[model samples]
Target: MKRIQSGTLRALSNKEEYFETTDLQRSIRQGYASLLSGEIEMPTPFDMGALIGPILNEGTESEFRAELTRRIRRFIHNRHPPLNVDVETVERHLIRRLLRTRKGQTTLSGIGVESSGSSQDWLQGIAPWRAVRDAQKEHSSVLASLGDNTRADIPKNILSHSMASVCGTLSLVPSADISELRSALGPVRTVSERHTQRIVKYLHEHTDWVHKHKSLLGREAPRSILRQRYRAVGMTLLAIWPLKEAIRKWMEDNPTTHLRYAMGQIVRSGQYPSAINDTLARISLIGSGTDGRSAPAGPSGLVTWWQHSA
Candidate 1:
């Protein structure tokens, strides 16, 4: 059995947006399979790191994203306080945010709920740009700029803790699960991680609690305490600088044509079939990469759904 320890594990996301997607060269998460080898057999280790190194080093969008997926997973699963986020809850939040935007569209807050990271990758694949548009708004900056009063009733520790957990949870999802992740990103279908990343980065920027209210009136100690809570998980005030700028820009442009262009770029990346299949073949449609997972299994544990569907 391949162990996670045997390979490099990087869990990362855009700053506080930790663990949006996790892709491992090691296929441990796929399922456990033991080979009945009379003699001990060791499968030669190919450099999965080699597969992702350039992507990491150069940050070509796809390679960078694949690498980002790896780091986020690491951050999520390895944090000190442990993230308790359920992917389902994230999906629910996406839904509520999408639902709320309609009522608040008149106000600047109309664009609060949106997708980020590879979360929107799949949607971008199926229908490209037109499938899901303006489904979620970038509210992180608003959350950050107004961090003082936005969730004032809630403890900074809770807010930071929640975002950290979310970022970490994102790390757990796999690349092939992009579609599953997109479908899970709320009511909107067909999106990409790049889409999710932008939205989330905006959220981190707008809702920067540490940089904003870490020293609010008479709460220096409490602020420190809250900041420390997030720091313990490897998140820091300086991590999301770019995200903040994006939010500021979004704020200036009412219609936010720039933001739309950025989101469109995400959809644009999957213009090739390889990228599309590479993302989709990861889930629902299996049997492509490692262990070419057998056809779907039946209730009786023998018949596969693929047998009928195929």
Candidate 2:
């Protein structure tokens, strides 16, 4: 019989620790076996880092932990029969292990280490982005309903410009004329007169939140809190318009990929979904230079630009 260290056996016997370790070990073993069998090539540690580092670096701590749990659960599901383990249990253990690691410790310490607090408590202490995200979530249903009603009425090109405007990629000066907003649609030939009107109308209606908070817009603290929330409808329009077709095609071809899963969540939201965390994770895994395969040509530039600007 192989000798097992007492600490190792104890770790394995603990249900939460057992599942995480078993799942990871199984994934590593399966990967190696596949490589040896010429079924798949091995990814270098650096490659793995490239696939995960960006998300860890850029995502909120809550997001990072959630994504980590998701990945582990997904990996286990893909490679084996369902484990008789509770999802919450596995996640709790994985989060603890992650926080105890050097990288996790550094990340937590940066936010001011609390001797005792939950991850949510830690997140609450750090950024206002969470508040922005919550506000967006609260409005997602209304935005979704609006899109369902108005999407068919608006032309695609106009929709794209409207979305970009919402993203703040296209400048919308408060003093700008509505005609100026139409002209910002760029040199697209043959824009329908009614469609143009719809775009203008949509922009005005959705951006009313910005005006409501107009006084706060100039102050950094207040503006930052509400900007993303304010842009929620535009973000939804962008996802539903120019990006939808591309995301649909990707999801069809790579149905089980994490990128596909994340994109699916965003698409389903039909509003400015809280997708930055998932998007970062997807980009880390498959975007240009990470996996040596470029993201799907459509919307890749927009996604790249959004990440940089956001």
Candidate 3:
């Protein structure tokens, strides 16, 4: 390989610089290039391979990154006035996911074996990948029943059943990480209804609840969850810094996005405390130590917390 000069090296996007750099970036870049060159058609049913096939030949994961990218790219090209796709945000999500599996493991396919094998065999060989594959299968079926369109309107009964199915499949995975929860819950985002968005929020809260009580539940807390907690704790150092006025201004200027999304932007924007510590603490206490009110059990408790908190 030709030697590349350190002085000449630079990040392709802003978010790329923040994440731990990975060789997978090259493959992802290649995939996008192939799409732009019309070398391949975007896959329907949104197979994982179509997006990452430049590196891995196959996968069965049901994560949204691939499909979301496809939609954003098409929007950019097809919009009459042109759309400004947030390539950095897309790349961040992709990199975080691709970097999850060990660097050299063949499991980087983002799902287990390309072909189906006996469930027992999969469970014995690669439980993590098997769990992801199964959860995706569940999520996919639910989305397909809704016409497989992100913008489709969803009914309450179908939505509830879909949530149950996805979360139930997820519960099968032992000590699932945030990425796995993300994979299981991602399809809900496909339907652009507020109900679906609320579903996503509830799932996040479920994850938070599980993570907080992992010891009692006989599971390990996901690293991402720990990081959020630690980040909240770390923000105390900047408590003395004056940021309330600036944040208020930010909220006023950006009124349309979800508060969580906007806070994430503020936190990642720079060296200021974004007041997410309170939110994290609230999520951490979702299912336990309540104010003498009986909330529904399990994931429904998560939904109840979201409703009450909102």
Candidate 4:
């Protein structure tokens, strides 16, 4: 106002620029104020690596990507404001990161992924003995339901010997290869890396059981039958390996005990009906050795062993 400063005319001529600068300065000051008052919250950087590491360690690449998307969605959903993250975008990022790592590259290479370095740590947790037991269970299930013209059909004697070999090997070494048991002694005796690890775990846990029974259980023919059928044969034998006492008492108590009668006695022993019936069916298949009938006498060694043990 009073002839405003000498160069004021020029400044007024650039009025638009001056006003823009003023607005910018005002915005900066307000931004600082908002920050101090906690109104303009800063975004935290999400750790995509931690989220992706374990997911990559899971089964397949497809599984990893699927899990990644689900997890990212869940993480965003769990946020207070429910972050506006694109799940597919995060999945693509995580997968790209995995593809960059050496371990991830090798794992997704489609060659022995089950035994990859990344998966070995996970596999190490499985018991080798449990693997052997599972394989044995699968074999038993097949044997129990043998059919005509089945390529898996092995002679009863050979099957029995193989079962014994498995028991002896496991009992003595606990980690010996019984891969032959799976293929019925075929040329191909392949075991997956995952199963190999499970066998390793089994050996670790049942080392004591194997050492104690290797000598006694290994030579016993009847024990092979039990091992072939029951998954818990080791524990079962531990409870009642020498059935001399129980057999003697039972013989004295019931001179003319029949398999059917034994089944009846088992049913009346206060156990669950379904359980007892299932057990009786399994036992009757083994048959008792005493009865002169063509069919097995009730309560054979298979029956008596578990009876005393149970």
Candidate 5:
């Protein structure tokens, strides 16, 4: 029989006592729920293969415990984004499992497995499993909302559930589709109906503009430029929604070849002359011309001008 050292015996006793405490018990419950629900990831177990050398050599109990702790800590640090569990919580579970196996009270089968049951059994009940089921239900609901292109059925705090997990699920969506945009923007809980409607209208207008001036803008006009232009217009409209009808009427009456130029003309002629300059400044397009000149008199300049003028 392998004789247990006094230090190892005492540490094991203390650990067993600690596990019985309410605080540790509650933490274990919460941690297990989080892990099983995929809110916090379970790290891969440390490679115990290396411990064979020292164990065969009859290393001291304290030395073995120290080595195990060191290896587990190293394993956690090497994780791609690092383990999210509390260090104390992880250490407690790891040390307890190690103690159980060393005393022959448990048997090791593989990573996260033991003869007594799986390492997950340490969580003590079915609560964690139920938490996982709830998480799956929530995830399915969010996916359904994305598929339907509507936020009416989505949970209010769904975005706050787990950003990384939510984003990973959304990554499966095709970027070219409107569903992708809806999914990305649906998480913005503060977005209002007026803002959404205005954004939809702006997108329609921009699409029409693109189709009309495909030759002028060039077929290869960078998608980034188009996105920036859209954002600029959207932000301007947000600031000037009360005046949107007037702006729309003005745009229809005096149609220029390009959207930006028309905006600049409006700014130059509108009651709020300084607004054009302000919007341009806000969007970092003010004075963006060769030789340190103010914005040019073309599409780019006009877009900036309109943003401020509106």
Candidate 6:
């Protein structure tokens, strides 16, 4: 590579910034389902791939970083606006997951592969991945059931079962670290580690793809509050230091567009906002910690705390 300098270097470094799934996508398919445990979800069957990434940490005896990256890249670009999987994104997922595994955190799929010294409630609370098994079966059934246009179909218990299985099986409760956690959980039968994580790999390959299905498969999918709660998150990135002049000029020039899409949005663009200046001024006037939160108000905005508020 030829030597590049200044702004070019900055742009290159900023190329693969963090991409959160919640922030992407504007439209959603209204229906889909699978026949998991006799319940159907709706349009197309529910694809668990969105909730869970395309790859699972299948406890394979393989070395960590290298194998993980290779598998991840394969999955992200499986469809639609394929994921540009970068080392940073991979590291973000890996580090967070590794920490969670070591710390015994809960996963979306209620399958906790944790062990609290082999306690009754702790281990019993966890369930095996039955959903994944079902998905494998439905994949066969649905293909046989439908033809070209499958726009209308209740989602069969297809991806849900398989994802549940893969997620549940691959997830390990948090211990000291990855290796220690693995050791505590026992031997490294990575391949036979309760169904090797091919499902995750598959999901990765087909990210953002809405599989077409028959009209008859339509049933009830996520709706109302649950749907709203899990709605796609839209983030507004702001520039650093916020020159606030050129943008102001642009807004003045093109008033209609800027007012709706840009203003009052979350300023996650690595910059301080003009709106919070007063809040900072007041904090400084009172000399910090008035809210009983913490010190250093510049970077402190919203801190979500979960406790016994009841």
Best by the TM-score measure:
2
lDDT of 2 at 62: 57
lDDT score of residue 164 within candidate 6 = 28
List, residue by residue over 154-255, the lDDT tens digit for candidate 1.
Answer: 223212333433332232222113234344333212234555443344334444322211223553421111121122121111111112233233435544
Please give the lDDT score for candidate 2.
Answer: 0.36
Tens digits of per-residue lDDT for model 2, 1-310 = 1223222333233233322345555776698678666687556653332122223423344565677888765654343322354433343343233334412432124432122222122122212222223433443443566666675664333233333343322121222233543343332212334654554455446533432122334543211111323333332332233343444355456646544144444444555343343333333322222122343333344344233212
Give all candidates' CA lDDT scores. Answer: 0.30, 0.36, 0.34, 0.33, 0.34, 0.28
- TM-score against native, each model: 0.19, 0.26, 0.18, 0.21, 0.21, 0.17
Query: Can you write out model 6's per-residue Cα lDDT over 1-310, one digit (the tens) per residue?
Result: 2223211222133343222232121211112223333255432434233432334433333434456677664544342232344322332344345434535653233433222222111112211111222333445565456553341222232323233222322332222222332232221111222222233323323322111112245563211010111111100001111222323343456645533223233334434455344333322322221223332245243111100011
- Give candidate 6 misplaced runs (Cα > 4 Å): 1-133, 141-167, 173-188, 192-199, 206-310
Q: How many residue pairs clash in all the candidates, one count each? A: 46, 0, 1, 12, 7, 42
Please give the TM-score that candidate 3 achieves against the real structure: 0.18
Candidate that would win on lDDT: 2
For 1-310, candidate 3 gives per-residue lDDT tens digits of 1222323334344423322124555666789888757788866544333322233322222333565566666654342321344432343344334334313233124432132112122122222212233433444455455543442433222123334333332322323444554553333112233443444444344223123223445556432222222111111111111233344355467756443343345555655533344323323322122334333343334333323321
Ranking by TM-score: 2, 4, 5, 1, 3, 6
Report how far off residue 280 is in candidate 4 (Å).
2.0
Model 4 local distance difference test score:
0.33
lDDT value for model 1:
0.30
- Model 3 residue 107 lDDT score: 18
Clashing pairs in 3: 150-190
Candidate 4 deviant stretches above 4 angstroms: 1-178, 181-196, 200-232, 235-271, 287-310
Instruction: Give the Cα RMSD of candidate 2.
Output: 24.2
Off by over 4 Å in 5: 1-190, 193-247, 255-261, 285-310
